[model samples]
Every structure is written in structure tokens, then in C-alpha cells.
Target: MNLLLVEDDLDLGNGVRIALANQGMDVVWVRRLDDALRTLDGGTFDMVLLDLGLPDGDGLDLLFRLRRDRQILPVLVLSARDALNDRLRSLDDGADDYLVKPFALAELLSRVRALARRSYGFNDETIRMRGLALHEPTRGVIVDGEPVELSRCEFDLLALLLKRTGRVVTRRVMEEQVLPGGQANGSNSLEVHISNLRKKIGQGYIRTVRGIGYVIDVQSLARSTQK
Candidate 1:
């Protein structure tokens, strides 16, 4: 999942970014409300982890602006304001879920999954295509009723390709979305991950698009499993 994290505190933001990245989420972190808004304007995200207090402006105003402009993505408010009214106000304004500060990361993850199921409608957090099933919460992969062990990068790569079944995912998009950072391409790391992922998932999936990119053909997926 692509997540936008809007936070000002350096320590907390770094910690959260690392934790989210460990879970195979593509996260973009910004400290100020203006930066957050600019990121939102330019990028597409599945969820927003928003801090109610920002350096440039109130995070509530940003939430309001998102709603006023009709951008209907899930927003989970992470605030130190623990009052009932604060929670109520956040929900009323457009936040999908609220978490008071100093909370557990496990709880945050749970809420994130719940919001994902709510927003995207993968009720069980499992995205299935062909003979493969990718479970989000456990990061488990199963092929033809057999479990497939995969490295973190391989699992993330498969999830991206599986989520976009039948659609081409370009190399640039994969690097920007799936790679750890700029230096991740030290020596064709993305291709290595894709090759490993394809091997684990088996044949007849993840076809290369010449010089363009890669895609998992949905029609071929059905045929592969059926045969």
C-alpha cells in the first residue's frame, strides 16, 4: 500500500517510516502541512497517516481541504488530543479512523489493515490471482495450496504485480514504489527481485514487456491454474 505520513517530530516520523517500510508499504513522509498538501496534490496514496499538529498549519485544515476538494481517501488521524470532542470532531471533519498518541504500533497496524479492508474491500486482506494468494497481514504467499517462502522484497514485488493484474507496471514505477531508496539500484536489484518473485510464484506469470516493464496477464493467470 502507498501511504502518506504527515508528521513534524523527527524521531517519531523516522520510527514510523521505518516500521511502515518494514511492513512492505510504500511511505512518503513530510513534516509540514504545506509539504503534505503538495505531496497529496502530486501523488496517489491508499492511506494518509496524519498528525493533527503540523509546523506550517493545523492538520485539521488539511483534512478539511481534502474533503472540500473531494479527494476521498482514508485518513487516520494520529493525534495527542485525546479528548472525546477531538475524536468526534476529527471523524466529523473527514478522518476515517483516529489513534491517540503514545499508542502501540501493533494497534496502528491493526487499524491500518481495518481501514484498508474498509476502503479497498479486500475483506480478508488476501489478493488472489491464478493459483497464487497473497495475504497482507501475515505477508504469506500460497500457490496451488502450498506455502511459498519469499524474502521481503520478493513478497512486496509480487504484491505490486498481483494488485495490478493484467496491467503493465513499468520499471520506473517499480523502482520508485518498491525499491528501498535511490541506492537500491546498485546493480539491477529490481530485476533480481522480480526474477526471484517470478520463480517462487512459478511459470506463466509476470511476462516482461520488452524494454517497457512487466505485467501479469489476467487471462493467462486463469488459463495457467485451470490447466
Candidate 2:
């Protein structure tokens, strides 16, 4: 999952970003609300990890704007305010979940996964499609009942695409989410990873969309093969 982290505290932001990325999730960290808004304007993130206090303004304003604009992306508020009214107001403003400050990273991760599942309409950690079984908790991939080891990038890429199966995923989105520094770094790492994934999981699963991107349209591939 690609996450946009809106926080001002340098230490906490880094810690959260590193922890989330270590768990095979993509993250982009910004310290100010304006930066967060700009990032949101152009980015295709799956969710937002919003801090209630920001350097420029309150994070509640961002949440209010999102709800006002009808952006339904899942948001989990991370705040130091433990007052019942504060939490209630945030939820009422449209946050999917809330996490108080100084919480355990493990618990935060769990909440993130829960929100991800809820927003993506996934009922469990393991996403089963076609013959592939991707177990998120264990970071395990089983193809046709056989375990297939994958690097972190490959695993993240596959999970992102699989979650959106039968739909075209833009190349820009994939590169930013999976590649380093939200870029290709002038290298063909995106293609290389995809090629390696294809070799390991078997072909005909991912198809190049020509000038646009790639897709995992099982039905279309099946139909073309039967022709």
C-alpha cells in the first residue's frame, strides 16, 4: 500500500516512515499541511497517515478538506490528544481510525493493515487471485501451492498490481510506489523487477499496456489464448 504521511516532528515522522516501509509498504513523508495537500493533488496514494499537529496548520483542516472534496481515501489520525471529544471530533470529521501518540509501532502497523483491508475491500491478509496467494502478514507468496521467494520490491509491486487486478496500473504510479526515491533513478528497475517477477511467478499474468502501463487481466489473457 502507498501511504502519505503528514507529520511535522522529524524524529517521529522518520520512525513511522521507516517502520511502514520495512513492512513492505510505500511511503512519502511531508512535514507541512500545504506540502501534504500538494502531494495529495498529484499522487495516487492508497491511504494517509495524518498527524493532528502540523507545522503550518492543524491536520484536522486537511481531513476536513478531504471530506469536503469527497476524497474517500482511508485516513488514520495520529494525535497526542487523548480527550474523548478530540477523538470523537476526528472520527466525526471522517477519519477511518485513530492512534494516540507514543503508541507501539506494531499496533500502528496493525491498524494500517486493517484500514487497508477495509478500504480495498479485502477480507483478509492473504489475497488470493488466480493461482497466486500473497500472505501479507508473513510476507509470503505461494504460487500454485509452491512457495516463491521474492525480493521486497517485487513483492510490493506484485501486491499493488494484484490488488487492482483487471485494471491498468499506470507506469508512473508503479515507478513512484516501488522504485527508490519515488523515481526510476534513470535505470530500468521497474521493467527489471517486472521481468524477474514474471520469470518467478510464470508468464501471461502481467501484460504491458503499450504506451501507458501494465495490467493483470486474467480473463482477457485467457480469451486471447483460446482464440
Candidate 3:
């Protein structure tokens, strides 16, 4: 998962980023709401871990703007405010979930996973399509009942593709969500990764849509092969 973390607390922010990274998540940390907005505008994130108290302005301001713009990205507010009104207002103002400060990282990760699943129209940790199983909790993939060993990047890339199953995932979207921000490799690099990924999984799993991007259409491909 790719996440945007907006927090000004140095210790807490760094700790959370490290923990999330260790769990196979790509995270971008920004201290202020301005930076958060800038990052949000530029990159695609699976979710946002937002801190209401920010240096430049309140994080709620960002949330409000996102809602006003009709952005449906999942946001989980992390703040020190524990008041009932605060919780109610946050939910009313488009926060998908809320977590108070001094919370366990484990619980936060659970919530993050929950929100991510919801975004993908799934209620479970594992997403399955056409005999391919993506276990989000372990970042594991299984094909034809066999476990497939994948690099972190490969796993993330496959997860993204699986989430969009039959659709053509644009190169720009892949770069933002799969690769590190500002470190998206050249076209040849992504092609090489895709090549290796096909070798591990199956060459029939992915299709390169020249001039557009890549796609995975297992059912469609199966039908075509049968014909």
C-alpha cells in the first residue's frame, strides 16, 4: 500500500513510518498541511494518515478541501482530540475513520488495512480474482494454489494490477502508486520489472498495452485462448 502520512510529531511520525514500511507499505511523510496538499496533488496514495494539528494549518482544513473537491480518497484522522464532538464532526466532514493519539501501531495498521479494503470494495484481507489470491496482510500472492515468491516492489505492483483486474492501469498512475515518489524509473525499468514478474507468475497474466500501459484480464484472456 502507498500512504501519505501527515504529522508534525517527529518521534511519532518517524516511528509510524518505519513500522508501516516494515509491513510492506510505501509511505510519504509530510509535517505540514501545505506539504500534505502538495504531495496529495502530485501523487496517488492508497490512503492518508492525517494529523489534525499541523504546522501550517489545521489538518481538518485539508480534509475539508478534499471533501469540497469531491475527492473520495480514504482518510483516517489521527489526532489528540478525544471528544465525542470531534469524532462526530470528523466523520461528518468526510474522514473515513478516526484514531486518537497514544494509540497502538498495531491498531492503526489494522484500521489502515480496513480502509484500504473498503476502498477496493472488499471486506476481507485477501483479494481473489480468477484463481489469483492476494493476501494483503502478508503481502503474499498465490496462483493456482501455489505460493509465488515476489519482491516487495513486485508484490505491490501485482496487487495494484489485481485490484484493477481488467482495466488498463496507466503508466502515470503506476509510477505514482507503485514506485517511490520522484524516483520513478525510466520506461525500460518498469518493463524489466514486468518481464521478471511475468517469469515468476505466468506470461499470460499481464498484457502490455503499447502507448497506453499494462493490463491483466485473466477471464478475457482465458476466453480468447479457448476460442
Predicted structure with the largest TM-score when compared to the true one: 3
- Which candidate number maximizes lDDT? 2
What TM-score should be assigned to candidate 1? 0.59
lDDT of 3 by residue, 1-227 (tens): 67899999999999999999998889999999889989988766667899998888989999999889866678999999999999999999999999999999999989988887766545456877666788988888888899999987788888888766555677878776677562454546677677788778875677888876787774546423311
Instruction: Residues 1-227, candidate 1: write the lDDT tens digits.
Output: 88999999999889988988988888999999999988987766778999998878889999999899866678999999999999999999999999999888888888988887766545447987767788988999999999999998888778877665555677777778778883244558887787788778887888888776787775564434312
Backbone collision count in every prediction? 0, 0, 0
**Candidate 2 — what's its lDDT?**
0.84
Better of 1 and 3 by TM-score: 3
TM values, all candidates: 0.59, 0.61, 0.63
From the highest lDDT down, the ranking of the candidates is 2, 1, 3
User: Which residue pairs come into collision in candidate 3?
Assistant: none
Whole-structure CA lDDT of model 1: 0.82
TM-score of decoy 3: 0.63
How large an RMSD does model 1 have? 7.6
lDDT-better candidate, 2 vs 3 = 2
